[model samples]
Structures are given as C-alpha cells and as structure tokens.
Target: MKDRQLYQQILGITTPWFVAEVELDLEAEEVHVHLAHQQASWPCAECGKPCPLHDHQNERTWRHLDTCQYRTLLHAELPRTRCEEHGVRVVDIPWAESYGRFTALFERLVIDWLEAASQQAVADRMGLSWDEVHGIMQRAVKRGLKRREAEPIPYIGVDEKSFRKRHRYVTVVSDINRSRVLYVSEDRKQTSLDSFWGTLTEEQLDSIEGVAMDMWEPYIDSTKEHLPEADEKIVFDKFHVAKHLGDAVDKVRRQENKQLREDGDDRLVGTKYDWLKGRDKFNHKRWRAFCRLRRSNLKTSRAWAMREQAMKLWDYCYPGAAENHFRWWYRWATHSRLEPMIDKAKMLKSHLKNILTYLTHPITNALSESLNSKIEWVKYTARGFRNRDNFKTAIYFHCGGLGLLPAT
Candidate 1:
C-alpha cells in the first residue's frame, strides 16, 4: 500500500477528511501526516444548519500516537463555516476536540499514563512538559465535573487537609457511600464548606441522611444554616472524639510526669505510647508489661480508663441506650480529678446531642480519613506542589473517580 493510504487507515479517516500527504523525517525521527477536507462546505457546528465554507484556518499541529520509533504528528487546516445565526466558527472534527493540541486517542493515552504514574513522571516518559500534561488533567476534570449527575447522597463526609506547611488548609467534601470527593475549596472556614452546599440542589441537600465531621464550629454553623434538620443529620466522627480524649490523657500524663520526676519517679517516662495504644495492640509480653504499669497508682491510668470507657459508649444500638451509657461515662470522666479530663468531658457534653446521633447514622469520617491518606500519597508522589490550584486539581484527578477521557 502507498504511504498515504497506510496512514489514512491507521488514523481511521472517514468521509469529509482524509490523509492528503505523509512525510517521514529520519533526521528528526518524526512522522508528519497532513490531512485535507474533502468538501467545499459543511453543516454549522452549533446549529447543524448547512453553510458555505468561509476559509481554511492556519496550519495546526497535534501530537499523535508514536508510529513505531518515530514521534507521530498530524498537520491540519481547520475549515471555518459561516453560520447565519451562530456566526462563523470552526467546524468540529472527528479525530480531535476543538482547541485541543492532541488527538483524542493521544489524550486518552496521556490520561492512562497519568493515572498509573505521577504527573511529572508521565510528562518525562511521554516527552511532554508538565504544563501540557496538567492541561489535559484540567480538561479531563472539567469534563468529569460536567458529566456528574446530581444524585442524593445518603452519607457524606467533610474534613480539612493542609495543602502546605504553616497551617494552610483546604476543606474536602466527599460522598462516603460512593467513596469519591465531591468538592474542594480553599481554607477550612464556614464559607469553604458552604460553597459545597451551594453546589447541591434543594432536593439533593434534602436527601442527605447524615454528614460526618469533626466538631468544628464553622462547619457546624454552615450546616445548620444551610441544611434542614441539621441537628439530626450532623454526626460527629468517633475517631475525632477519640483523638480529643487521647490528647486529654496525654496531657494528664505529661503533668504527672513532671511532678513525679521532682520526686525521682520515672515510670511514666517514655511510656506515652503505652497509654495511647489500644489495650489489645500490644503483644502478650508487652501486654503483661503494660498490665503492671496499669496496676500502679498513676493519674494517667485514670485518664486512660475514662477515655476507654467513653469509646465503648459507641456500641449501644439505640440513641437512648447510648445516651445513658455516655452519661455514666461522662459522670466518671468529669469526676476523674484530672483537669484535662474535666475540660474534655465538658466539651464533649456540649455536643452530646449530635454525638449520640451516631447511633442513628452509624457513619464516621473513616472513609474521608482513608481518602486523605491517599491524598497525602499524591502530594508526596508529586514531590509537593508549588501552586495551590495544581494541588486541588491533582486531588480531583486522582481521588475524584472522574471519567477523564474525551468522547471520540
């Protein structure tokens, strides 16, 4: 077969478009295929009304799939149509999308490579710059966001993650049941979460059964302002609750350790993890060692016990039973003679109404936590992002579960 015929078949050229010429430059190790239009006029891209051809656009070049060992490029002249209502615009082509510098097939290849590797790694492997690869990602995310359907999400999670050091953070909203990121915005303030709520319709917002998050006042205020019946729908995450308790216990340990050191007692030194770790986390020998530590009359022991008892309150099936159990633990915690425990107990009690809502929702930000772990990996893989927009784009591209390919 002739070279033009071979390239035409490989490119899948159909009517109204064909491979007019093929040039192989061995010195540059590139294959250039020139395309031509077969008709004098075509239908308007916007309204589908037939119009006369206006003129040929300037020569355009697009990177195509490599032909063997040579880099393949396509040269084309986009035909313009003079539409009466929509005015003159370039007609759409079959092989590529409008304003794109790569064929649809080549973009698909880039998307796959991006999913398998980091953006920088994919750019290095594909002989493309970082901006070119990121542009594809930007377009893919735009397409995916446009295609997402507004369905009722039964359970959702909202959390904050740092984009960089020095306390910079972004709020992330996710569909817990679907296990995908729904929205992301700068900062973790009330307005940051409010923007996500603004994206949902009234019906969609009404369909939300529960939202799991930490007891951040801004998030609470935002939800209370936007969502109907927000009291019942807001479920404080159990893990965040545990974190609070753990910090209280650690504080107790630190103060007691300082006092004991004055008296030459060193038992609490380097035993922070022993109190923080779950009871069963230690092996049999370590468990026995910790048992001896627990037997001592240590103030940290009382604090740790109170935290453990509070964690068990989550096992009750009904809110009434859970509330009763929590009250029992709360009384013990408040009276534990540790200032930190008293402070934490008071804080948790203030939010007790929503904390017990966990019985009905039984949902937590565990999935959101899991997604955050993946996001951390993404950041590490990229060697950290200098641009905040690029950081957000990377999260959506990797964790949004977006269908990020152009339709051919």
Candidate 2:
C-alpha cells in the first residue's frame, strides 16, 4: 500500500477526514501526516445542526503516537461552521479533541507514563515541555472527574494533607470503602469541608453511612450540619484518639524526666521514644527494659498505663462496653494527677459520642492516611508543586483513583 493509504489505515481515517499527504524528515526523525476534509456540509459544533462549511481554521498540529521509532505529528486545517445559534465555531476533528494539542492516543500514552513516573520525567521521555505534560494531566483529570458517577460512597474519610511547608494545608475527602479520593478543598476551614457536603445529592447524602475523620472542630461542625444522625455516622478516627493520648504520655514523660534527672534518677533520661512507642513495637531486649520502667512508681509510667489502656478500648466489639471502658479509663487519668493526661482525657470525653461510634461503624481514616503517604511520595517525586491549585491537581491526578485517560 502507498504511504498515504497506509497512514489512513493506520490512523483509521474516515470519509470526511483523510491523510492527504505524508512526509518523512529523516534528518529530523519525524513523520508528518497532513490531513484534509472533503466537500461536505458539517453539523454545528455547539448545537449539532447541519450547517455550511464557512471556512478553514488556522493550521493546527497535534503530537501523535510515534510510528516505528519516528516521532509523528498530525497537521490539519480544520473546517469551521457558522451556526445560527452558536455562531461560527471550529468543528471537532476526528483525530483529536477540541483545544487538545495532542492526539487521543498520545494523551493516553502520557497518562500511562505519568502514573508510573514524575511529570518532569514523563515530559523528558515524551519530548514535551513540563507545562504541556501538566496540561494533559489537567485535562485527563477534568475528564475523569466529570465522568464520575453520582453514586455515593457508603463509608468515607475526611483528612488533611500538607500543601507546602509553614503549616499550609488542604482538606481531602476519600472513599474509605474503595480507597479513592472524592473531593479536595483549599484549607481545613469549616467552609472547606462544607463544600464537599454540597456536592452530594439528598440520596447520595442519605446513602452515606459513616465519615471517619480527626476531631477537627471545622470538620465536625460541617459533618453535623450536613449528615443526619451525624452523632452515629461521624466516627472520630481511633488513631487520632491514640495520637492524643500518645502526645499526653510524651508530655508527662518530658516533665518527669527532667525532675528525675535533676534528682540523680536517670531512668527516664533517654527513654523518650520508649515511652512513646506502642507496646508491641518493643523487641525482646527493649520490652524487658520497658517492663521494668513501667513497674516503677513514676508518674510517667501511670500516664503510659492510662494511654495503653485507652488504646485497648478499641478492641471492644460493642459500643456500650467500649464506652464503659473509656469511662473507667477517663476516671483513672483525671484522678491520676497528670495534667496532660487529664486534659487529653477531658477532650476525648467531649468527643466520646463520636469516638465510640467506631464500634458500630468500624471505620477509620487508615486508608486516607495511606493515601496521604502516597500523595507525599507524589509531591516528593515532583519536588513539590508550585501552588495549591497545582498541588490539588496533582492529588486528584495521582491519588483520586481516577480513570484518567483520553478516549482514544
């Protein structure tokens, strides 16, 4: 077959659009396939009404899939139609989407490579600029998010991810059951989380069974305002509760370690991490040493014991039993004379209703945290995004579990 016919077959070029000419620049190592349109009336790009072809658009080119190790490009002077309602608009082409600088197949290739490597790396390998690669990513994510179904995720998580240094953050809402991000907003503000609730339908909202999140007041207030029976559905993540207690134990250790060292009792001097570590984390040697420390009459030990007991409360299969366990644990901490433990215990008490909901909902932000780690890896691989919009785009592109592919 001739090169034009071969390219036509290769490109699956149809009646209205065909490869009119083919040029191979051996020195440049590129294949150029120029396209042309036959005499035909075309439908309006906006309203799909049949209209006369008024004129040809300015010549445009698209990066296409490489042909036999040679970079390929498609050049076309697309037809324009004067629609009565929508005015003169460029008609859609067969080989590429409107406004796209790359063919569908080429964009698909970029999407596949992007999932495995950083954008810069993909751009370098694909012979494209960083901005071009990012534009493809933006378009792919936009397509995927637009195509996403209105189905509600039965269990969800709302979490925060650090944007850049200096305490900047973005809120992420993920489908806990499927482990995909659903929404991302600019900050941890009440309005930030409130935006997510607005996207759900009454049916979608009603279908939501639970939301696992940290007890950030903004997030709590937002969930309460949107979800009915929010008390039962909002599960304060168990890990967050554990973090609160862990922090309290660390504070107790710091103060007591100073007092013990000043009195020449150096037992607590270098055990900062030991006190902070979970019980099972200790190996045999460290476990034996930690056992002796816990056996001592140190205020930090008592505080550690309270923290450990509170963590164990998560094992209860029933909410009532768990609540009772927390009450006993709370009483112990409040009367234990450790101000840090007392303060943390009181805070947990105030959020106890939602904390105990974990027994029934049995959901946590574990997957959200896991996805956050993946986002951190993406950010690190990209060496950090330039701004929040770019960062948000990167998050949706990488961690949203989106079907980010051009329809080739």
- Can you list the residue pairs that collide in candidate 2? none
RMSD (Å) of each candidate, 1 decimal: 1.5, 1.9
Alpha-carbon TM-score of each model against the true structure: 0.97, 0.95
Candidate 2 C-alpha RMSD relative to the actual structure = 1.9
For every model in order, what is the number of clashing pairs? Answer: 0, 0
* Candidate 2 segments exceeding 4 Å error: none
Error of 2 at 195 (Å): 1.2
lDDT of 2 by residue, 120-213 (tens): 8998999999889999999999999988888868999999887678588899999987788899989899999999988888889989999999
Candidate 1: where are CA atoms >4 Å away? Answer: 368-370
Leading candidate by lDDT: 1
